[model samples]
Target: MIPTPAFVVDEPLLTLFAGRFEAALERHWPNSILSYSFKTNALPWLISHLRNRGVWAEVVSDHEYELALALGYPPERIVYNGPVKGRERLRAALAAGSMVNLDAKREVEWAAELGREQPDAGLAVGLRVNWDLEARVPGESATGAAGSRFGFNVENGELDAAIARLRTGGVRLAGLHMHRNSRSQSVDVYRASASLAAELIVERGLELDWVDIGGGFFGSLDDSPTFDDYVGAIRECLVGAVDPARTRLIVEPGGSLTAVPIEFHASVVDVKWVGDNRIVVTDTSRTDLDPLFRRRRPFAVDLTTASSATVPTQIVSGFTCMEDDRLLTLEDERELRVGDRLVFRNVGAYTMSYQSTFIELPPAVYVRDAAGAYTRVRERASVSDYLRGNSWLSPES
Candidate 1:
């Protein structure tokens, strides 16, 4: 029996991605550190693989920090980063000796307090600066660009003040962090960011151990830029700006690691003809499989069935009450049938991370080995899983 709706990860593709990343780092910044951003895909299996490859864990939350620790990543190897770090989380990171990237002025003070409490602990801290650049993706802005909520606006006094405060407070400034753009597929954009980083360091006269170019590198996909091109562009931009002997480069890659390795599969449960449209209902919903549907992002869908012929255009709908829960609307009048499977590719990054168990639990996750073998990685959640922590009972109950 086939699973109604499932997520499948291709292990071979992931291995290729890991190798490409390591090779890129070695070629560009030989002494640099590559950290995997946990917010992208925090699966333990993926995290363990990154750890095994000597990749550090870049965490944005306490849960991610704990998850990294659970994956056997040493505290020193993890960089704690985020806009909101609760007191307890901050203390834990400091006590664990993880490098904390201070997002705000208050974070600097908090780190100072932690340092004072544990004088011998000696915490290393960095600052996140705003770059004020726009990204290639629609509706996704750059972190370093103006009006971004993340990072300190260097145009303003924020960056200068933060640096001065740390310098006078005797705090160890370890690095500079910037996540300028989400879709950093274009080499020009990445080079611009690198130039900006170099300019900021030189203008501020700040001594830094590392310069963190936060991950936005596009992964390998037919529609996306190649990994080599993206890495080469970054290398070109930083070639003369950063001293290879003095400063170590750091990158936190997220999407580039898992995008091409995962694919979503859903089985058609029902088929109907309405007016001039053919609607195919699937077991998966926008909430369960592709949350990008909610944002009106078009995903490429391919039909996987026994028939080798192409069919008419059809509209794909989910088994949900919401009218917005649509996977795709085939404009070519493609025909679809029950029991047929639809495959959504390049959805490895934000789809599962943003998936919700609303109306139904998320689908199971399967792993495909190099030999074309499939195994269940995550089991399908039952209705009980959703009601576990809920106190509200239905009237029928």
Candidate 2:
């Protein structure tokens, strides 16, 4: 029997992507490290695979920190980051010997306190800088930019002040970290950021260890540039700037390492004419399957059916109350029927992470192993799963 509306991860494809990234890191940074951002895909199995292959963990929260630990990542190999970190979590990370990328001035003080509390902890602190670089693609804008809620503006006095404050507080400055806007198939953008980072380090006279050019690398999407070409561009730009022998380059890649290896498939349930448009309803919704559809991002779509017949122009939508829960619109008439499979390619990244169970919780997720067998990873959530621990329960305790 075919799987219902589910997410399927291609293990071989993911392994291949990881190998390419490892090769890139070795070629450019040599002794540098490539940490897989855990916030992207926190699946324990996936993290274990990365750890086994020498990829470190980049965590943004306490749960992720715990997950990394559970996955056997030593504190030294894990990089803890995020805008808001609780005191207890900070203490845990500090004690574990993880590198904490301080976002705000408050964290600087917190780190100092932690240092004082644990004199011999040897805490290495890095500051997140805000580099105001526009999206390389014309008319494209990344989620993080100058006005973004993340990082400090190094161009302004903010970075300088933070560094000085850390120095005053007796916090050892390790290196500089900048997460620019995501670059789409533009290696020049990556190179520019790398070069600018090196210049900033030199100008500040800061003893830098690891330069974290944070993740935003595009995956193997139809519109994205080839991975090899993008890697070449980044290498040229980075190598031309800093001496690889002196500093270690750390890349926190999330999507590029995950997206191409996953597939989302849903079955078309109904096809009907709504006003002048033909609406095809599927078993999936935007909240659970294709949240990126709300942003008008394109994905490769294919139809699986016995008949090769094509229908005229049609619009694909989900069975939800929201009129905005539309997935795709075909300009040509595409004949679809109940039980027809709709396959969405390249959904390994933000899709599942941002998914919600607005109207209905998402279906189960499966993994296709190297031997070409499918096994369930996450079972679909039942009603009881939602009701569990909910405060508003019936009088029947």
lDDT of each: 0.77, 0.76
Off by over 4 Å in 1: 118-121, 134-146, 182-184, 222-224, 292-297, 307-312, 331-334, 389-397
lDDT for each residue of candidate 2 in 167-186, tens digit (9 for 90 to 100): 66667888778766553536
- Most lDDT-accurate candidate: 1
How many Å off is the CA of 79 in candidate 1?
A: 1.8
Q: How many backbone clashes does candidate 2 have?
A: 7
CA-only RMSD, every prediction: 3.6, 3.0
Please report, as a residue range, the 10-residue window in candidate 2 with the lowest summed lDDT. Answer: 136-145
Residue-level lDDT for 315 in candidate 2: 88
- Relative to the true structure, candidate 1 reaches a TM of 0.89
Cα TM-score per model: 0.89, 0.89
